[model samples]
Target: MGKVKKTRKNTYNYNVDRKKLRRRAKKKSAPRIQCDEIRNAWNRSKSLAGNMAEMGLVADPNKSLPIRERTVIGEPSKVRKPYVLEGLKAAASLPSKQTMGISSDMIMYVRHMVENYGEDYKAMARDEQNYYQDTPKQIMRKVNLYKHHHTKEYQTLLASRTKQ
Candidate 1:
């Protein structure tokens, strides 16, 4: 057989070492004159006199300037009353009503069916606690929802029943 070519493993540092060395070599070989001029120009522009020149303002050499207090144009001195607190108070005064999910009575009915009848959906449908008169399928669906929501409780109930 002919000599097989070796393959390198893919990694973050693959070929990075050689590229870093090449970059270092290139940087060392480059002239520093232009870099030094650019750095000096940057330092000059960052000075106080340079800043005043950029802003079209002249600095007075004879007298020291006084620091002026910054004033906000439209802000009021007094704190305003929050309207959100009033809305929250209004909401708190009203009685709360359950708008989503099954009612507490429905939950109690499902729990009764599960505890008394177990998985016997037909028996659950005929149960007096099932005031809605849910069909076998509807009873099964409600039982499933109850099981999903109260898994730990359902398991404990089953364990207690088995123990009895």
Candidate 2:
């Protein structure tokens, strides 16, 4: 014969726990205060008088402290670059199929970088795009490769397209 199954029941009662909690809560109604003389010298006493003064109950905000002026020095002020519709227009134009050993995505990515960040190749490498996933050193190598192969042709193509 198979063994009989044992039944389980939840014995958790809220009323019993609630009564216990209320009894404990009543015991903590009054908080004990520490005398300043009994406390460590380094520790500040949190008396009612100190709290009231901290809330500006006895002091004027204006007379409390003088504001110090901040002077910026040794840093060149950032001047906004002139309007550049040409770079955007150039990047937007699709590259020709005749461009050797270069995918359209690579051309577009480089052109986009040039349009937005100019020759700041580190900024270009730090872009969140998959194409710019490589470290700055690797990206610089790729940029040098692009420059060696297609910089002049790309520039001429851009000049012609802009002229049109």
Superposing every Cα of model 1 onto the true structure, what RMSD results?
22.6
Best by TM-score: 1
The estimated TM-scores of all candidates read 0.37, 0.30
Model 1 CA lDDT for position 67: 56
Model 2 agreement with the true structure over 21-103: per-residue lDDT tens digits: 88788767534435332222212455543442433232244433436653322112321211222333554485866655866
Which residue pairs collide in model 2, if any?
none
Give the alpha carbon lDDT tens digit for every residue of 1-164 in model 1. Answer: 99999999977767568978988998886534343223333333255444333333223433223355543221233213234234446766777675346667767887777778777888878877776788999988877777776788778776766676
Q: State in Å the error of residue 93, model 1.
A: 36
User: Against the hidden true structure, what lDDT does model 2 obtain?
Assistant: 0.53
